[model samples]
Target: MEDVGLNQGQVFLSQNVLITPKKGDTYKSSRLSALDLQRGLIMCLMAFSHCRDYVSSVPNKNLSWNSPLIEQNISSLDFLQKSLISLVAAGGFYMMMGIGIFLLWQSRIKDGVNPKTIRNYLVCRGFVLVTVQFTVLALFETIAEGQFYLYVGVLFSLGICMMMAAWVMYGVELLKTKSWFGFSKIEYWLPLSLGLIIILFSHGVIWSNHHYNISPDVLQIALLLGGEYHTPMFFIDINFTPFPWFPSVALGLIIGKIVTTKKEKAWAPLCALAFIFLTIWFVIRTANIQGLFFFGDYKTISPNSAPLTWQSYMSISKFPPSLTYFLWSWSINLLGIVWWFKLEQIQPKLFTSFKALKIFGQNALFFFIGHWFIYYGLSIALPYHLTTLTGIITVWLIGLIILLPLCKRWYQFKSQKNKNSLWRMF
Candidate 1:
């Protein structure tokens, strides 16, 4: 939603100061309401997970139930639930982005843009993402090995997703216009299912990276999720593969088109289907089926490693997501959508205090840069052992306390300006 940019000052100082095309206004959409909710939660989860992973004494850094964090407990079902929550939390953003691209693609066509030229230019965006990724790496990668900068993080993934979105939109137009797959409901569900299947395998590959070295895995995971940080760029991130993830954009387009333009009353059935799949996930994971009949070299390589059938079950190598990882995260996101529609009222009181939380969520990219920059600089200049679970919770709370009141007016202004719409996607 933001970059390492100038709004940094105005965003912090004023309550109702309008960010002039300064990225504060763009990408605000009702469609992203649920998506932003999902992104904010996942981004926080990412911060916590990374903090724990880098910090010692947390036991299970990735926030996985399989980790010692849960294993140490007598009955650690909570870890499992957390893992599931983490898994599904982040994927919605990509799915939403894909959907956005699809809509844009359609709109562009309607507005008389050449499809081929648009596709080529869109793919070029990947290079731009790679360019920015390397710039960040050069600026920040201080360590020799295992440095976070070796591979791209979140932004790179979206870049590739954007490129993929262009392609997928082309396919959507082709399929629907050609009737190759009958432009009915089947077209929507088919691509969605295919993307989910590819992501499952990609998830397995990504976990393998954590067990050993990630330099090789980085490319695979990057490609899987859309982009990675490998300079040579030969080894693609397979975990977040373009094959499936791109199609998800097409699928999202179809769904969005159906919902907004078609005005179809199809969500009730979709909600029912989501419940069915969710029930299955609960039953299987709860029964302790790690989805592996025999744990292979997973344990041998890294005791922390387990048979990863679900990508979201683990830390999910961020730059790119695996098949299982992408699906799991999106699955939870889908669940959120259903809940938002079906529940009508989900503890509105909970959402009230969440005003502060919602601000951090909305301005996540800025918040991430701010916190990480602060954390990294502070840790280097004046390192502290204040990152244990207690410290993290304290820091989390303290950070929110400091940021909330300071940033509340800006949020209030944004809320008032764009008061009626739920998601603020330009």
Candidate 2:
């Protein structure tokens, strides 16, 4: 990670010659306040989205994120609002996770840690995430909904994907020592190339589900691939399946490499990539051919008009995030990264003044679990009639305010622990 206070005159002496890079060549660190602010905002948005569960006017028991937005008959504003939220919430989280993994791996290597120890720590951390998702977080959901089923959500997907990616990277590390073969090239491109393959194959998975009569017993794999499947014993619901969601993390790793490894500033190249992706997203969505997995037969919103225009055709699915969703979400997220990087450089005090976002980002894992407890507990304690949007907004704000002090305390406590402490897992 580049230090925020990095000196522009810092130079390396090569063969007794001091080489100083230009002022504009310096890049901000990935571990700086900018990244924290982004993470903080994502957590806040996630909490806002969850607040809808108990605070909204209408019941969302059957709301499927897998379904395309066009099918909902929402206005353009509604679609845009949901898209922006989804882009940052789930997608942003996974991408940040990837960046976190890369940074952790790099830090460990720099500190001369044993490879075995580093890999073991990551695997253990992954298990901790999996356990919390299934046990603690599941309990929270059960309490809120008054029902009990295994909670397979973004956290679970994150845990599984993290472990899988860790092992893959470990294997790549092992290959580096073999001079007889050209395995070094696999380190950087493997994750990204595999991610693309998995993403493309996901559309085929959707097609397969429609054309083929897959058996119910085997269909339980939907927890990995996505879509609904049932068994005689239990009902399984998946929000972010592992394979489909892996690309976000994989892309994060690629972006992390760019920001951290480059000798020059990352904003320009990142901005260019963002624009490129934005263009591709627009073209594909306008075509309405590929990049769309759940496009159902078009239907008229009213008796008098042709099937709803471009809005219906362009809207994308989320549950397993279609290619179009992937493109647009990441494009916007990339721009966000560049913006935050610039913000850190131009207005450091303004960036630091958002203390709530800082606390939330510093203790992200704690805030993630703690916020749910605050909101859901409050919902149960309060009157059931408080379902209006205004009511929810008030509740959400109060919940956040309540959480701020608690998150600060948690951050303080976590900071005192050793790097290897179990508390560090949070």
Best by TM-score: 2
User: Between which residue pairs do clashes occur in model 2?
Assistant: 2-29
TM-score of every prediction relative to native:
0.61, 0.83
Q: Give lDDT tens digits, candidate 1, residues 1-426.
A: 221111122222234554444454222232334444545556566556444433323343243212321233322433553465445544565655554455555556666778786576566655455455556533554342334344445455556666665676566556666555664655466556656555555546544665565644444433543433355423322233444345345445555555445332445654655566556545434333343421211221234644434432343333343333444555666666555433324464554444454466566544554555444443444355563467655554544455555345545544444311222221
Q: Once superposed on the true structure, which residue ranges of model 2 sit more than 4 Å away at CA?
A: 1-31, 58-69, 75-77, 180-185, 212-221, 225-235, 289-306, 384-389
RMSD for each model, in Å, please? 8.5, 7.1
lDDT per model vs. reference? 0.46, 0.65
Which window of 10 residues has the lowest lDDT sum in candidate 2? 1-10
Residue-level lDDT for 22 in candidate 1: 49
Model 2 Cα displacement at 317 (Å)? Answer: 2.0
